[model samples]
Target: MVHDQYMSLSLVNINITSYCMQFIDSLCYILVILGLVGNILGLLIFSSSRHTSKISSVYVYLATSSSIINIFCVIRYALVLHSKTRIIINNLIGHVWFACKLYELSFCFRLISSWIILFWMFERVTCVSKRLRTLFYRWNASQLKFIIPCIIIFIILGCVIGPPAYMYQPRISKNKLSNSTIKSMNYFCGLPSTVSIKWQKYFNELHLGLNHYTIRCFFSELFPAGTIIIFNSYIMYYLFRTSYQFSQINENKITKERQRTTSWMNIVLILHSCLFLSSLFSHVVGHFLSVEAHETWWVLLTVLGNCSLNFYVYCLSGKAFRKQIIHIIQRLIILISYKLQTCKQQQQNHQYDNFKIENLIYQSNHVENINQPKSYGTKNYPKTIGINSSSPISEQETSV
Candidate 1:
């Protein structure tokens, strides 16, 4: 009975594993398609526009970075989907250098994407603050070109710690009793094992303990998320305070436009904050769970959410973005309709020319018969008035 129960449990585990893999495969494909389309559209809209405000320029950079990161994520997920299952396990174990390096690259991009959001929040806070408003407003396009690259370089340098954190080594073990050999991996990123003599001696001699997951979670998830929340809260407070101040003053077109833009920014900030917070929560939960937990799904969901939400947020909140999208769509429609009409007109002209040629041919044949030798009982052509008439042909051609 115990053996049977064990077998049943094994079967259940296998079933669950199969189902999870299938789900992840489907989700990856769906995210790849949707994320690519959405991010590309966003890239086009943000990059092509001319913005007088520095804040809008900041948004353009943010959107561009997000689109790029989304593309990277799609590629990363596609690689995982296509690679061997054991390769993925080795990645999780942190023993395969190739997988570790690939993960590190993805991690760097993820950090950049997250920091971009945090920086955007900071920019908003600066814009909304009365004291900093003048300073931020004075930031011109040339300064933006310098500032954005500097920030990007800083983010890339900061995230360079990822590769070493996930370092590992491969090993093999043998079970003497079973006379079987098994492959084992050692993660240098985790706490040193007390039971293994080699690890114990290594740890005792070096006095080092590294927990990559803990460090990564704190820096990548906790710190950035907390910063975003704090800045976003300050932005909300300042926006409300500014609204009250504006209400006290006399309303004007400029004030109204400022208010509208502020409102849109606030809405976008709130939406993005909610999305990032949810993703952070999912990541934190996945970290605390067992290896067998369906954490990949959570990770995939987080990636998909982060990649796709920005476009929707912009569409819903930014009037300028919406107008641009609408304008582009209208132009496309007009262009297509014009081409279709031109084709139709061409077809009509061709048919009218054919009709004219056929009529002329018939008239010429009738005139020829009239000029030919008359057969017995064949009446002479009456000057071919109807068939050979130029007036009717001219009229037909003119009407066509």
Candidate 2:
């Protein structure tokens, strides 16, 4: 009797898992396609337009990459949408597992990426200071903008890729579904099973659990995310105050640069703040909430926490990017409409020419028969219209 019930529960759980995955797959597919198109357009426009050639373009590059990371995550989600086993314990979790892990890591890295954007933009403001101006002028004058993006990319690459490869699986806590959770939930939802490992013990000699779940969040989620929030928050406050000094008339040139920097900073701040807050909320809620609630919507909140907001940043802050997006959308619309008109015009013109040709043929035939004794109608024959060919003309001739 017990074995039969166990089998039945597993069957129901598996069915729920499959349905949940299908829903996630559909959601990710839409976001991935849109994000890939949008971010690529952003990059292409920024590269061509001279508006952001200054050091700040370096920062825009970082912001662009964060969206790109989201695009990558969604693409991986697409490939594994059919997965049924929740938290499959394998020797080493590959792309599917990494995709889930990366989704969380993207949250923290987004803050880092956001900071670089604000940093680069703020540098533009600082460059106007007589003291700081020369350093940046020298930096740009020497084409050192490459260094900023390179460093940020290295940090991001290290944050996501390096840690897991070296660290191995610590401890992951798996929650057995409670009767209440199973009753309330229609799907299988698993949190990052808590595996506690003390970072201090790993780095130093202190004794702490390795399989605990919070450590992963501490190092990967909380630490990096907290650093980003604190660092950028201070920068944002200073930027706001400095921006108000724009009302002062003595330093108009500096003020303009500051305003641009401040505006971009505000955008960066808001995006990161929302992301950080959402992630924090989801993490806290998941740790405390029922398994069903965490599995169903909380995970989605966590996955989409940072990724969806990037389009907002690019659209609002980067003029070059926004213009390029507008141009591409306009170009797509034009291409669709342009061919329709061209085809319609061509058909009308073809019919008009054919009608004229027939009229001429009728009149000429009438004239030829009337003058049949002496007239050859060949000379008056309307010249055949020139034929267009893909291959080049090989011959030209007078008729034999």
TM-score of each: 0.60, 0.51
The Cα local distance difference test for each model comes to 0.59, 0.51
After TM-score superposition, what is the CA distance of residue 368 in candidate 1 from its true location, in Å? 22
- Cα-based RMSD of the predictions, in order? 13.4, 14.9
Q: Against the true structure, candidate 1 has what lDDT?
A: 0.59
The alpha-carbon deviation from the true structure for residue 296 of candidate 2, after best TM-score superposition, in angstroms, is 7.2
RMSD of 1: 13.4
Q: Candidate 1, residues 263-372: lDDT per residue as tens digits?
A: 87788778867877876786665544434211245655675657655567646766677787788779879999999999999999999999999999999999999999
Candidate 2 yields a Cα-based lDDT of 0.51
- TM-score, model 1 to reference: 0.60
Please list the residue runs of candidate 2 whose C-alpha ends up more than 4 Å from where it truly belongs after superposition.
1-30, 55-57, 77-215, 218-220, 231-235, 248-268, 284-297, 318-321, 339-400
